[model samples]
Target: MNTTSRPGSPAGLRDANRRRVLDAVRGAGAPTQAEIAGVTGLAPATVSNIVRDLAAAGRVEAGDEVRGGRRVRAVRLVRRAGVVAGIDVGHRHVRVALADVADPAGAVDHAAPPERVEVRADLPDDHGVADGLDTASRLLDEVLARTGARRAALRGAVVGLPAPLDLATGAVGASGVLPGWVGVPVAGRVAEHLGVPSWVDNDATLGTLAEQRWGALRGVDDGLFLKLSDGVGAGLVLGGRLYRGPDGTAGEIGHVAVAPGDRFAAVCRCGHRGCLETLVSTRTVTAMLEPLLGAPLTIADVVARAHDGSSGSAPARRVLADTGHHVGVALAGLCTVLTPRRIVVGGELAQAGPLLLAPLHAALEAAAVPGTVRTAEVVTADLAEHAPVLGALALALERCALAP
Candidate 1:
């Protein structure tokens, strides 16, 4: 048999196809053989053969994942052993995740899907800066040990705080939110505990980062990441990068009024009446529904009731729809000003899914500038609750690449 490596030769064509399969695996969102075939324009059988050969040689790992209520084969390129940490400090809980980051110098983005040895932990939202720092430090050590990755392999850690962090001053804003965290250098504290460099940013901003890199907002240069959890917040991804303004308050859309004249409007934490945050946060929306249901309901309960097939699901869904309507009202002005290409609705309430998005879409269509609604799309977050932590990991890898 001829063994010439020319592109027209059988061996060369197989090699080229194999390379295409590898490239597809390295790209974002192409995990299954069918997906790889779509990306590389290769036959499904050809992609499967390449994947099988790669797995046999230990160049890739194949696993099963459930998507759309079905099992699919997912494949990923084997990566060199290196680790990074992402920490999410919520108002009432702390979540830490450790992920493997491949060589940053690779041409394609290094994909860090949750690993088989994936390790995540929840720590109590301890009070006081010192106590939180101490607990976080201990948890990082435990996580590293559990993953069997040497602590020395850690490149860096990125911490996301619920409160806004001024990129210029390295100070926490929204002092009333995390009062104990005020005036504290959270990144510095994390660095001390992990004995490695650390970076910090607002949790919502991190969510934006994660989504743009790996989730629904991927491939879009200008987009908005709207998080509607305990409080309302947003992160702007403009020019393919997170656009934190000079004071790092660029995406503070929450304080903008969306219901200025409504009778239900209340004073917001920012001392403003009818602010979007006052109307759309988990607390406010649930409070609005509790009276209708004749009982106090958590955001989770509302989401559960809104998921269809539940008794009286309409009431819960109506509450979410109303909240979405207000959010869309606020977003209309934002769209008019910034003209983002897409809006990813995230946070706890996003779990309500279509119940929220439908009304949001309807409101945006009715209120936005004549052509504005056509330019932007509103959708739920693909990363869902994990966006911040994954985004922290993405930041760690990116910053490490820039390190001298």
Candidate 2:
């Protein structure tokens, strides 16, 4: 019996439509049948039939939920097999998360979405790839134990690094920016250790993927996700997809010169002076206040002081606002070139909330082209610290199809 069918044949058309429905649910988190229909442009009855078949096959869970005061049938993916992993290797911490994988062929009888969990582990101020990889492996084992899944149950992993990463060779692409890990095939090593299919990208780029799928960039075709921490970096979502340019470093916006006058005078790690990163990073912001307080300070400490709402804290708040102004100045140029619809602010500094955003917005208004500034709305990130890891998970789900 032949199963193959021509593209125009009824069976082929049905398979294509079923895929359309699956992609809609997988990408949109959980959406009502009506919303899925709207996205896929499929008739409600066809969507209902495909969804029912899928639910029967243990690929998704469907239920009645209230939306806008009316009950609607909503659907979401359910994990039926092994777990997919997301690892975020930041400058000073490694955060990891896992979610259940979808059943590829109705192999399991499940009705609920898979549970998800994450853990963050701190590293010393300076550690190399070996230390980071060891820390990540231990956390993976710990989380796997919590899920009652053995190491063999791991299906796929995606790593997000805080450096320019070459996807083809799975190596950190640049030097000076991330000295300890430079030129290291960190992604390849992770994949070898995990014994599973794996992928890697810049941590900021992953943040962009997370935002597009689950946070501020949802339904946005053109947007940016910025991680403003010890250093500045950006994730670009152009034409509704993550764009890494030709060499996979599209959003290294921190090095873009933002300071006035000579761009070569202020020394940056990249050997450039007056780079945006030299001025607006977490360390730079805290350095400004450490003198007045007569003590060492972290960005988190500065943000806490700014939020305490005391006269003593006014200086802290003012510094953050000023930092935001500098950030906005650089973004004005970015907005001019990209004309993104939205810009999401993440990282530890974004914790300052309006203290950072108000001035940031003001600076953009003062600097950016009037038409471009109005086209982009700067907003705080929704997922916060968890975003990069989630983005890795999103990438894994897409690349591996969560099938195994």
Candidate 3:
């Protein structure tokens, strides 16, 4: 057995084949040798040999499984060694998730189905900077404990703030949805609390990443992700990469002033009047429906009511439709400028479904250039509320040095 490592040598060929097989198993979740062979475009014998070697080395696990009514040896990446986490900080709440780096499931590309990563949610986000970081740290710690992984097992993390991030400083930009977080080095702060390296980006940007990599926007090189939660913001993907612009505010569409009259304008979180956010945000929707509901209302409450057919539900539906129209009006300008191939709508208010989408689509078509509107697809996000967190997880896996 010559141990030469040159490309033509037996050892080199086996090493390359081993990598191909391992990648297939990791991407396929529980692919059999035959399945791995098909995915990796390798011979069945070669796949079997590589799987056997990897299993013996504790890099992968194999078990008997049934596929298409046939029994086969199912192979999957081992998870005992390490994991990564993604944290999403919204205007209303926080969400966290953990993923095994070796078997990142669907975090990478279309090669494999994504794994069912667990997420802990509903951690409040109304607190000041220090308190918000503390809340995020506690939630992350709780998720790690629930998964039974040691703190040291956390390879890295990605924090998604519902604001524009100044990439140069890792701080929230001037128009951050959470004012208290302005100028705070959010990624560094979260990293300090978690005792691990961390990275950060806008929540909408992460949502776009998740959709492009795993959800509805897959394969779309030029796309837009519109997040309508506490506020209205956007994430852009141009030429297959996220476009953050010179100041990382490229997609901060929420702060763009829309209304003309000061009397008609409502002050936004960023201190601007008539911002797209002031008209279409969850808070704005709730405020508009309060008079009809005769009580304080939440976005969820409005969405739920809008779905009902009762006369009382009429007001809720009307308000949501109006908000959608405003959002569409702003997005029309964006579509004209960016000319994305698709626009995926996500965030809390998007749960209103057709009640919101229909009006938004109508307004966009009315405002945008006919050619642009026809070319741009406006669709609901497939990942729903979990997109940002999953995007964060993908970010961690891509940036971290997790041993697999």
Candidate 4:
């Protein structure tokens, strides 16, 4: 049996064609060999040969029978034949998920742990990056061991980081906020430590991928995914692909200006005043609500109060509504350009559900182009807080699906 050629200039066209076939199967959920050929615009014999090779390599599996009398051998991704690990490194926490390449719905092993360093403004970035990487590697090892997956069977690994990434080198970009990670090649280091192939991208980008694949953005071809957690960011998906843009910084909406002066008096980690993050971040909302509630509050606490409609809920609602307004303002321009079919919001702040969405909907209605707004659906992430980790898993699956 002939194996797919390794990715290289000489074999680039073959690799590209193989990837197209794999993507066709993944996108359509499952397809027959004929269907794969039709969708991918490849020759039937080529598709048959490719599928056979993939099946032998444990990347895909053949299912029984055809819908009609066509003798179709149904083919679907073999999600469990090999394992892949996904790790999410956030500002305040780290999460890990272990999944198989053949069956995405199969039992997934997961772990979540608080950031290794104390949550403080003064903590060095190096400490956070080093500790986070260490914690992620350990968690991945545990999940693999617990699931009884062999290291040799690992297909790939993907990580979601809280900061921007240099896509070319897989290094952390200049986010000023993430201290010790300025020049570190995060993906390379993680792969070295874990002894497996690994890839990394911005957390919001992964969340967007997760949402698009399995959540609110399901069938939409173009959309925006906003994550409102300890921080604020957006993910852009256009033309049915995650758009990282030039330098992998396409969706840094958190730093979009929402205010003009020092009147708000809040400085953002990006060194900007009146950025959207300064107004809508959990920290800012909690601070604003604390005085009104006459008590300390966490983001979860505020969301609970907002949901319960307590007298104290008013302040939290107001903050979230205002944040929604700013988000809508920034998104208006994006909607005009991308014209997405939906907007999926995720993160800790989105836990307030309607409290955050209602205002966001209103603001978007007010800000977006009249007819365009009607074409777009704004909703919360169906996977909620798990979006990033799931996205990482999806990324891993994507890599495995295209493996030669």
Candidate 5:
């Protein structure tokens, strides 16, 4: 005897068909049946049936529309059921975003420009963590209220930190970059403060995700994101996914030894001598400039001075060029092994633009093999400093799916 299933009788087939139709509708706003068929690669009959079932279950809305002189039913996803939050914690600032969970792509725009508040990264006292967390939570609440969303409407939140995280214990790695937060469970604290589930990742990794999703790195499977701020860090995108490695330290390019035996080598926060960060980080450049400038100066001041056309900017430009050379030397090794298709530089130093990137390119060409150096194109990040926070929103929206 032949066992044949009736129409829509096999549960698995129906579920798969439903998912395909749902995904197509979500991807294409208000698509006709023929359009949905083309997008999902399904027959017209299958598309019609799936749309009918989805409409009945209140998962989608179908309306009559005329397309090319013919009548067609347009299908669209129902409005998102809940909201999600994205939190980015930098060395000296915190940024947060509130967005709709159902439409992750649109979450980055909920706050338009996002909200940021500066706090000391050193955290010299015991109360630093609590105070910082409270400030971030308050900013989150302000943005939620501005967006006409209640705190209870939040489904989840994603937090980005400037340091690598131990995947197993949810703690910052032993880099000593974040002295006050080495052992603190950042995700847990954010979750408790906001009364929503929270997740954490390195800020550079999140920046890579944001760029791949919404900025210059779109469609690039092999790409590298370098964030040169108070400290230097990197994020890698390989095979269309973020590579965290076994211990979530795959992108710690800052710690790679570059000027190990230099006479003026400075100790890195990680307690390493002459690491790449020691030579290329904004902090290092600032320290190098303080004596010549006759006073302590911020990284922004240095970049501004370098852009100045006067004689005073000569020292600043020289230092930045030298820093770029060292950074390119470290990146050359990475390019030899990974051979990424693109390199996006963000953070404070990136604002130096050609002043920094030009020297970096020259150094990379001088160091790496010609073939590998030619394959990767280095450019400034399109999303700029907001990349990490936008990436956090994308993470929350993708990971926190609510029931229909």
Candidate 6:
């Protein structure tokens, strides 16, 4: 990589060189001044100047070290110079975390419990959007205060929503399931309330970010992160980047038309029939099993029963296996196109483990292209249900560190 800045005005070139130096330091971990100069391909004097500037900015720290029988300066990222906030707003819950830039792993120091909230009805009479936004703002405030992170201390904030967000406007698009969120500038509203820069993206995208940084897919350049819960979505990390398409709806595999006009077709929130979500979502599977059990059952209850074999009801296992099969079918198509090295399953439904993975692996083997299926490894999300929240913190850290 070319570390030299383009020929430009003095200030612009200087800033570019500074960013390059900071990026090299972050990517290489702790290194001596000579090591940084060698990796960045910059002169030792230039590296020294940049390191001095970064130290003054509180972005980097330096210490004296013995190198070649001489005292040499070593530099590393400052882990606690500032903090960033990550907020995840889902259809049924909200999560927030606070973290710093140098420790991009996640906000292990501070986390707020998942807050349950009601979704606004599609009808005009519903005050769902207003109430939900208010509740989210209040929870954000509490989380930040609890973490001892003040507004000024926040370098930036990142929010992840369950719906498809417009990348250009930060608003929910027409195809989104959250009717109240349509036309709502979520990032702007949250930023205004929190008095910080806020960016919003899909929950799956954030999940992919978190997984890439610290979860199952760490160090893998190309992978697929499937989130199976109330709905199915994917985060495609290709060439070490999150590939959100022009419309910001690239990984919406849930609404894909799978079984058109079938008598068993279930209605989808997107007003479609026989979509993948209809057959595979936790909502659908849990609803089917709840009636059979003659009692209300949550997805957790179903997993617990399947684990203990207490519900020897074949229907419970079948529901989980069937849902896994549907997911594998969808992933087979994805694998053919993307050929990712790994596929990580996350969200509420993934807790079933082999009850889901067994059927999913079998379906993938049966449906995917021969070579691709053999190479792809399907595994459970290491973070489990907390993937998105931790991912949001990672997103915030990246934004803050890369900010101009």
Output the number of the lDDT-best candidate. Answer: 2
Candidate 1 C-alpha lDDT tens digits along 356-392: 9989988988888878778788899998988887777
For residue 30, give model 5's deviation from the true position in Å. 3.1
Which model, 3 or 4, shows the larger TM-score?
3
The per-model lDDT (C-alpha) reads: 0.76, 0.80, 0.79, 0.76, 0.77, 0.76
Task: Give candidate 3 regions above 4 Å deviation.
Answer: 1-21, 27-76, 111-113, 116-126, 261-264, 401-404
lDDT of 5 by residue, 269-385 (tens): 788788888788777788898888756787778888888776659999999899888888999988988899999998888888888998998899899878897978889998887
**Cα deviation of 390 in candidate 3 (Å)?**
1.0
Tens-place lDDT digits, model 2, residues 164-274: 778778788777677788888876788888899788888899888777777888889999999997668999988987899998988888888776578455787876778
Over 317-368, each residue of candidate 3 has an lDDT whose tens digit, in order, gives 8998898898889888888887889889998887888888889889999999
lDDT of 4 at 253: 87
Between 2 and 6, whose lDDT is larger? 2
TM-score of each: 0.73, 0.79, 0.82, 0.78, 0.82, 0.81
Between prediction 1 and prediction 2, which has the larger TM-score? 2
Write model 4 residue lDDT over 11-104, tens digit each, in one string. 7676677667666776688788888988988999999888888788777888787566756688887755677778877776788888766554
Ten consecutive residues with minimal summed lDDT in candidate 5?
116-125
Q: Which stretches of candidate 5 lie over 4 Å from their true place?
A: 1-28, 32-35, 43-59, 62-74, 105-128, 261-264, 290-300, 402-404
Candidate 3, residue 13: Cα displacement in angstroms equals 16
For model 1, the local distance difference test gives 0.76
Which ranking of candidates, highest TM-score first?
3, 5, 6, 2, 4, 1
How good is model 5 by TM-score? 0.82
Model 4 C-alpha lDDT versus the unseen true structure: 0.76
lDDT digits (tens) for residues 98-216 of candidate 6: 66565442232223222211122222322345665676667666756776656677777788877787898999885547776888898888788777788899988888777877788
Model 3, C-alpha of 68: deviation from truth (Å) = 20
Q: Pick the candidate with the highest TM-score.
A: 3
How close to the true structure is residue 368 of candidate 6, measured as C-alpha lDDT?
Answer: 83
